[model samples]
Target: MPAITVSRRQALLGTATVAAAAALSGLPPSRTLARAPFAAAQAPYYYRFAHGKMQATVVSDGILPLGDPSGTFLGTSKEEIGKMLTDNFLSTASVVLEQNILVLNTGDRLVLFDTGMGSSQLFGPTPGKMLANLKAAGIDPKDIDAVVATHAHCDHVWGIMSDDGSRNFPNAQIYISQADFDYWTDEAKLAIKEPAFMNAFIAGARKNLLPNRDRLVFVKDGQEFLPGIQAISAPGHTVGHTIYMITSDGKTLAAIGDLTHHQVLLLEKPRIEFAFDTDPKQSANTRVRILDMLAANRIPLIAYHFPWPGVGHVAKQGDGFRYYPTPLQMVLDQKG
Candidate 1:
């Protein structure tokens, strides 16, 4: 609930490490392209699955490889973190975070949740592929009925605008939590001095969000902005951070946004602190509570930063939890 202020040192220890690395190093964008770029005549980076009657598309925005987990993951040592990674059969030296953009078709309305990096070059050359992927998924940006954001973080909101800083989704109404809309748009607070890269976050948020003020709808907890989609107030990663629960025909899917960054470390050690969280203690508390409920209810989840097509279910394992990735099931294309 307090004012959000980020420093370069703090960012280095959080999710912003990639941004810090790209900015501080003054390095050039890598000649290497992100995997399966549509620009290179590759397979489309999207997976289509069904959540009850609604059709969901998980679009890829490429991956960001954060160099190390040392300071970024607090309350644990590098050796301990490395061991956890090895135990889970994951990479110990680096963390590869996925940027999954979810789209849903609820019969009448075409809804998009959380835009990807969108041509932003701040975190290296790996991101900014969401727009192309959306097209590959056979969805046009102008046809989107609603653009709902879980929060205003740079990676989540930057794609709302085009390269010329104009509204990208011209026909869509923008929706966000009232709390985050107030916090990120506070120009005075964002001016209090922080890392240069942090400033880009602030600027990017403003440019993308402010331009759509008239069309922006501020939502609250438990409010259903649409027919079957309701907002769940899950704060701490950022003030007013939220996740949407989509329910229909006796089935429910939780569109979890940034609740947990890593599949192994965060799920196994829910109490571990994250430097990127606006309120670490609160973030962990919310995470544990949500994970417990999801595991108990056996609800499937779509994680924003999990592996590609981040659809999975959680199970309680001792003092921790284990992720059971939902096996891909083919759904035939709808006939006209």
Candidate 2:
């Protein structure tokens, strides 16, 4: 690690000045407040060396606002949930769902974790900014050799193809968990769901995956996806929902997707389940177990819905756990 460069600090200061003016004028700032102007001064990219010759960069596409749903957390009162938000210094009425897609450079092969939401989504006009962000980090989507999906959710799997249904990563192999594929592909299961939203997810999975069947590889739990990456079975949010662990230079990072919608409430009240969970009790159990292990080992973790650059470590506080976002310097120095 090298000392912070003078030029970088000066650039950060210049950005802060502009943001201050915007705030004073009572105008909406163009950037997210979670990442102040000074933090934005440090490029949106975070890097870490892995597997001796590999490097990983976490990139941000954008964030979606999750409106207040009276029953987001199962069996939790709205008033109680409001207080949880306040205690965590977050807005009670709204939640920002962050979208992150990671790039892995293994020296010989380039891989992407999830494709992110495609450009046609409601979140933003440019929903699939993974390619654009990749370019900023000096990576070409065409050069990617594989696209590993944690599950078949629309946001995580839709970007596999372009707006016109053409393969976005033309030369890459797509990997998904076997259990996840089987559950989503069953037509009988789709018929049982009446919710339009749930139907859309089922339809999208079928459409996006069917055509690429020959290219899709089914991964099993505890199997090595790559030289330093292993799949961990973490179900309940969805059948076959899985998490990935990347180890390098004695450090490990767990990429847990949608395990918890809101970090504050989920971590603090693991016993309370969320409505979105397919199996509420099972999800709660997995949540508690995972949080306990993370806190015990002091392992760093990343959540797809957590705040941008969503990398952090868990610490046990009272009967539950607390999420402590990684310091900027530590984030910059981790070995992916």
Tens-place lDDT per residue, model 2, 1-336, is: 234677788789988988898889887768555754554344554344343355667776667665674546667788888888887788877667777677777667787887777664645464566667777877777898988887887778877887677888888888888888887776776776554457767767776777788899877889997877888888888788888887766677787777766678888887777766777888888888877887898888777777767778888988888889875544444543
Off by more than 4 A, model 1: 1-42, 194-197, 333-336
Write down the TM-score for model 2. Answer: 0.80
Q: lDDT: which candidate is best?
A: 1
For each candidate, the alpha-carbon lDDT, in order, equals: 0.85, 0.75
Backbone clash count, each prediction separately = 0, 0
Return the TM-score for each candidate structure.
Answer: 0.85, 0.80
lDDT of 1 by residue, 136-220 (tens): 8888989999999999988899889997867778999998998998888778766756544456667778889998999999888
Q: Candidate 2: which stretches are off by over 4 Å? A: 1-53, 120-126, 190-193, 330-336
